[model samples]
Target: MALRTEELMLNMGPQHPSTHGVLRLVVTLDGENIIEVQPDIGYLHSSVEKMMEHRTYFQNVSLTDRGMDYLIALQNEEVYCLAVERLAGIEVPERARYIRVVMNELQRIASHLVWLGTWGIDLGATTVFLWCFREREMIMDLFEQVTGGRLHHAYYRIGGVYADLPEGWAEQCQRFVDYFLPRVDEYDALLTANPIFLARTRGVGVISRRDAIAMGASGPVARASGIALDVRKEEPYEVYDRMQFDVPVQSEGDCFARYRVRLEEMRQSARIIRQALRGLPPGEIRTRVPMTMKAPRGEVYVRTESARGDLGIFLVSDGGETPYRVKIRAPSFSNLYALTEMMKGWKVADVIAILGSIDIVLSDVDR
Candidate 1:
């Protein structure tokens, strides 16, 4: 008889704590090494994509926001505006663009902080997790001031934002950025220098530049691999061209490099927010929208540099009041594709650290 393949199988999640949400992974292991890993998503499926067809332009704003209930309003409204803006061929007002950039960058920083904190907890570094979340709360407070709700603001609409910046918003944003800037270095001193973190992450879950590109990775994952592919830098959407900031790239595409990339990105985001505020002009937040919204009988795609990665909305209109087809190419779904390759030859415990570093949000994966 032929020699045995010597395979062992384990279910890592669907109920595992580190999954971060409803995600399941069927991993095939050769002894202690992972040979194959398949992500079984949609356990939290809400089918938001299919539902977008029924709602009108304004009424559908709330649907897209529902994808990552964690990013709440900023996640949905921002992408939807890009979709609708491309459809209507409208030029958003400068003030609205400024405010949108400010809020969205803040949200990106907050989102990364949550990732940092939670990743630490999964790796047994509990203190960093708590400290990071504490800082993230400060940014969330800023979101509440302008958007009213902390989670889903639905504040961004087509052509412009829902309304002007709330009173003292600029001053408050300036204060937040100033207060937040030093904390980036604080995190560096806390985690970057810690030997335990360095050992666990320095060379683990390594991916090459060619491998990352072939795997369709984006955001920090692709950046860490020295690809330097950032939608913000590449596309320059929503006044990104007007702002000056460097995109951090690491030649080492290991887990540690991914950590450093996001940390550096937060500092850049803070810088962008400050400059946008400096250029903040006085104008209408929302351009005049018609009662019956209709896109031309053509198709267009708009992409944005979301905190996760490249978030794209492909919109198809048949000269109708609502989108005929809307396809959301969620980055997490693509980013998670490399997990099998990354997990091979690693221990089971290291899987959490690896997955968390990729920062795959389940909603983004499922939808």
Candidate 2:
């Protein structure tokens, strides 16, 4: 008699740890091999876009922090402020621009640390989780020193920042940068040469360059697939055009490639921060604006390279204090769209490894 076969349906979760933040994966399995994966999202939706319409431009900064990708809250603030500044024809001061760059890069490194550490836990490499947070805590201290809020710092203002760098903040940041680079190598030593990690990540969860672009994947996900596009390099917002850094790219497009891209990106973020610190200009950190500032009657769209990917905001203003319509092109949402493409054809055991590689934040997805 011929062999008998059947496909099984498994709900991976709106609660499972590997699903990474309230994502539900309706997974189809033929034995241990995955036949199809359909992602069910929106369990964490907060209607933040709608909320922006009722909040003033200034109040929306804080909303962006909690409502979007909270990992890199400063970047979220930067993009939102940039939109409001453009719409209202406000020019940010020179010193403020450099400070934004510095904080933005620092936040990028911090956010990637969170992703790396959590991903390590997902893959059973608990040491990486411990070591990554060890460094991230230092960055958090730096943030707390300046912004007074470690997690949700609404530091970026419409024209610049909420305050100037506190006393010794620059020196402290320099110390952290000097200290953090060597620690990255330690992480490499642990995972880069590990046989088990290599077996699980290498040649797994591969996505082609064409598919990555077609699905609107950005940041490390797209760059890992050999798409050499970064908004910092392409659009040149703030002081990024003047900064010297490399946009790391890999052709493998596998989980290992994603890991390598993010690792190198952390190094590059440090590079940008060093340059921003070295070229720190002297001027006001924030430009004075009315508490109830109203933008002109027009619409503006702004894009910033967030820790996750290409974060964009479209603001429609009717010469009012609050935005008439707000639409956020969250990078996590786009990157998550590519997850289904990445998970198919992999073994059931490789699901967590693959899901962890994309690094999705549900807040960004559901916002």
Candidate 3:
């Protein structure tokens, strides 16, 4: 007798904690090694694009929050508002632009914190999970103080933010930024140097630069794979053109590389926040627009760098109060498509490590 072998098909989720959220992974396994991983998505679909067509442009801002990536709701609002503003030929005040940048950067940091904390839990670093949430709570407090809604803040308006920074809000934001940077180094100390973490992530889930680009990876995912592209740096929406920050890039394209890129990105987000606060301008926070405003009869597409990647909104107006057609180019959807490439040829144990590294929000994927 030479040998006996068989392949097994395993379903990882639809409810499993490691699958992140309502995702099903049909994995083909040859003993402990993975042969193929097919992701089954759409369990969380909200049909947000179709819903946007039935609501007014102003109403759609709140929809974007709950209907898509709820983690970075402000960024979602910013991109949707940008599309409407462009289509309607509205001018956002200078102060509002600066405020958008500040809020957007803070949103980026907060969203990344959620990813890091959950990922830490996935990797069995309970301390990292606790510490990450400790800091994220501070950011959440800041959001609640300013926007009045911690998670789904309808803060960004068609031409500006819903309101100006409340009293002491700027000072508090400065304090958070000052306090948050050192903590990132502490995270580095904990997970970045741990031998177990390194073993699980260092050479695992490797995706090449060419495949990353071919697969349309963006934001930190693409940057981790040596593709140095960012919508803030490339397209320069809102006041990002005025802000000073560096786009972090890594060439290794492994699970560790993805972790390193996101950690550095949190630091850069703080950097951008500090600059925005320092150069905070003064004026009206919003430009007045009619409650039932009708945009021009035309189509416009706008892209913004959300917490995940390139978030885009394609809007068509029939010179009416409601959108004629709305299409959202969600970053999580594109980033999730690259999962198949990342999970191939890894051990069965490496699946969670690779999937968590991508940071996909189920709503964003299914929207």
TM-scores of the candidates in the order shown: 0.96, 0.99, 0.99
Q: What local lDDT does model 3 show for residue 32? A: 85
- In terms of lDDT, the best-performing candidate is 2
Tens digits of lDDT, candidate 2, 116-235: 999989989999999999999999999999999999998999999999999889999999999999999999999999999999999999999999999999999999999998999999
* lDDT tens digits, residue span 1-367, model 1: 8667788888877988999888898988887778778888888787777788777778778677775445535855787788888778888888888888888899899889989999999888988888898888888788888777677777888788876777887898899899888888888888998998888898999989999899988889989999888887788778888999999999899899999999999999999999999999887777887857888888878888888888888888888888888888888888989776788778776888899999988888887
lDDT for residue 120 in candidate 1, whole number 0-100: 91
**Which runs in model 3 stand beyond 4 Å of their true positions?**
none
Please say which candidate is ahead in lDDT: 1 or 3: 3
Candidate 2 steric clashes = 0
Better of 1 and 2 by lDDT: 2
Consecutive 10-residue window with the lowest summed lDDT within model 1: 67-76
Score residue 169 of candidate 3 by CA lDDT.
Answer: 91
TM-score ranking of the models: 2, 3, 1
Question: What is the overall TM-score of model 3 with all chains considered together?
Answer: 0.99
Q: Tens-digit lDDT track for model 3 on 15-102?
A: 9998778999999998888889889999999999899999998899899999999899999999999999999999999999999899
Weakest 10 consecutive residues of candidate 3 by summed lDDT: 237-246
| Candidate 1: clashing pairs of residues | 73-152, 73-153
> Ten residues in a row with the worst lDDT in model 2?
12-21
> TM-score of predicted model 2?
0.99
